[model samples]
Target: MNIIIDTVVKEYDNVTIDIDGYVPIDIKLVDSKGNPPLYWRVGDGSKSLLELAVLPENGFLSAITLVMMDANSIHKVGNNQVELSCEESGLPIVNLDLWKDSANNDFSQRFIDNFNCDMQVYISEDTILIKIIESDNVNWIHCGGGFYLGLNEEKNITHLLINSLTQVDITNFTESVC
Candidate 1:
């Protein structure tokens, strides 16, 4: 007797989907040798994990709280942006933008220009204002604003900011922080 079966495996690449009713839930950063670097959980229940595999040995990290949010309604920003209100004075808190155009993709500038709205991006404590000057021949995305935390001119602040915010178990922070 002989038996045979046919099967096919499907592979799907990760893509960014529009998040609805998402606010800022919590941000956590963790650093340890040979461990995953970053984990993010948005208020809309969207989540992602990023691993920095190429770091020096014996790296240690902890979450540094620059700002805190309202306790009762922690994750309710009306618009797509994760806006915040300052707890101290009841003022508007600027939400940090974490999205970036792919380095290999040259369509970012053109896309922004066609829209004609200033792209606001936040990295660490700084808000970056971006305007598309040209896209056809330029190789890099040139925009103004860098290093809100006031680092060295040559330092890769974007990388540091991203690393700091992305390395943690954010989904379980409510339990862990308690």
Candidate 2:
């Protein structure tokens, strides 16, 4: 199996991951002064994958480790949200604006309660799109997509698309090999 990670940024960065089977993943968080402790949770509707806790220090930054087994799980940690999907071919797209709505009246408290960490406030109505595609002959088990900000205002809305291919030997479950 293979894993792919993708990131996108408008005013802030957004990341997505794709994986096959169950795998352990490690994430890091920085302990910024005057900020609340970071926390993470994975859930599908009411089903949560983890309990809230302070991220552990792993070397330079705090880390959040998880062994993922489901593809439909959504992870919300600090100010970031992640989702996984399985796709064979073609381009996969993701939008980065679904995180928070600063224009809403309860945005402040809601954002604070969810992330439990300090976050920079940026009030701009912008949206970013990302796409991912397979690029090599090898069969890929994971894929990701994201975008980043640009220098110029005209170029500020950036789009990033990635294609990944793996060389892992694939096995068919139905065919019994001797």
User: Candidate 2, 80: how far from true, in Å?
Assistant: 18
User: For model 2, how does the per-residue alpha-carbon lDDT over 1-178 read when each residue is reduced to its tens digit?
Assistant: 1111222212211233222233222222223243333333332213222212231121111222333213222222232211223223222122212223422434332121222211111111121112111222222212223222111122121212122212121111001111
Which runs in model 1 stand beyond 4 Å of their true positions? 1-25, 31-59, 69-151, 154-178
Which residue ranges in model 2 land beyond 4 Å of their true spot?
Answer: 1-22, 29-38, 45-61, 72-178
Top candidate on lDDT is 2
Candidate 1: deviation at residue 93, Å? 28
What is each predicted model's overall lDDT from 0 to 1?
0.20, 0.23
TM-score of 2: 0.21
The TM-score values for the models, in the order shown, are 0.16, 0.21
Candidate of highest TM-score: 2
